[model samples]
Target: MKRLTITTLLAVAILSGCSSTEEVVPDVPPAELYVTAQQALQSGSWTTAIERLETLDSRYPFGAYSEQVQLDLIYAYYKNDDLALGEATIARFNRLNPAHEKSDWVLYMRGLTQMAQDRSFMHDIFSIDRHDRDPEPARKAFRDFKRLLDRYPNSQYAADAKARMIFIKNRLADYDLATVDFYIRREAWIAAINRSQQIQKLYPDTQAARKSLPLMLTAYEKLGLQEPIENTKKLIALNPVN
Candidate 1:
């Protein structure tokens, strides 16, 4: 009798625990979830906001706040430093709402997500042309920002986008100059000259292009190429350092 009574109590306690666990996230109304997410966001609880917004987004795809929930989720992902997820959410938002009035904001966020990628120096030196190299996130950010400006010239985001595009352009020229430096280190004068010339051709306005001219002159002198040396000198004279 005593054993059977103890077994029954244990079973009841287990069932009660399971019930409490199951009810932790009961099917709440969409408004309730949205409010919870909004509170979380207001409190700067990014993780909680993400959880609630994700749940809200899933449970109420066509609900009144569906679009807002998606936007919130994208922002939460960004705040959480989960850039890959933020990028995925941005793509989904764009796909589902091609004509959204806030499309420019989405483009802005997408550019930020791309620009936030790793920019550390690589273990392997880059020797290839800028176009031939792995498509850097900086380049993608530049393209996305360009699209934002082109599609919505008067967008509030256009000024910032143009600024970032300039930064990216300079960054790209700097990377190309790194290749030029690597070629110089290897005593590959012709390769260095080619990269430097390409930098000037592709990035005429960049400081790196101006910096490359002297390096190109060095290569020409090393190769005993008199005419090219004089031409490079003339070019350098035209663009003296400020």
Candidate 2:
């Protein structure tokens, strides 16, 4: 009897422990979830906001806040440093709402996202030179911002978009200059001259154009290309030296 009684107690304890160990998920309603997410965002609790927003999206795909939640999710993703996810979310939004009246806002945000990514943490924080780094993100951001400007010239976001576009363009010019430098270093004078000329043509008003003239002159002189050397000198004369 004693052994049987002890066995029963053990079984009861095991059952009690199992119950205590079970996970309890909150059964928040979609509307309440969205409210919670908004609260989390206001509090700067990005992780909590992401969780609530994602839960709301999953639980109520067609809820009243569906579109708004998706939009907010992009900002949350960006804030959380999940750039890839943010971009993917933007793509989904664009695909779903191609004619959205607020598409300029989306384009602005997309441009900002790409601009943020183009910024290199290593270069920014560590003081490393990113002139030779990949310029694709900057290029993409420039295009997005340009599109926003073309589509909505008076948009409230246009000023900021234009500012970012300028920065990206300069960075792109620097990237071209970096490539020209690389060719110059390799003693590939003809390649350097050709690339420098292209930079001058493609980025006429850029600092790259200013720098490319000197580079082209050097490359032409190196190769005894007198005609091109004289032409490069004339181009350099167009920019008055400070």
- Candidate 2: Cα lDDT at 76: 93
Evaluate model 2: give its lDDT: 0.84
TM-score of 2: 0.84
- TM-scores, all candidates, are 0.80, 0.84
What residue pairs clash in candidate 1, if any at all? none
lDDT tens digits by residue: candidate 2, 1-242 = 98798678768867875774423327977777788899989998877888888787788888899899999899898887778989999999999989888889889988889987886644664477677789888888999999999999999999999888777877888898899999999989988888887887778778887988888888889999789888878988986434
Q: With candidate 1 superimposed using the best TM-score fit, by how many Å does residue 114's alpha carbon deviate from the native?
A: 0.4
Q: Name the top TM-score candidate.
A: 2
lDDT of 1 by residue, 1-242 (tens): 98798678768867875774321444788898889889999898887888888887777788899898888888888777689999999999999999999999999999988876634223212333343244488889999999999999999999999999998888888889888988888989999999999999988999999999998888999999999999989999998755
* lDDT, residue 159, model 2: 95
RMSD of each: 12.9, 13.1
Determine which window of 10 residues in candidate 2 has minimal summed lDDT.
16-25
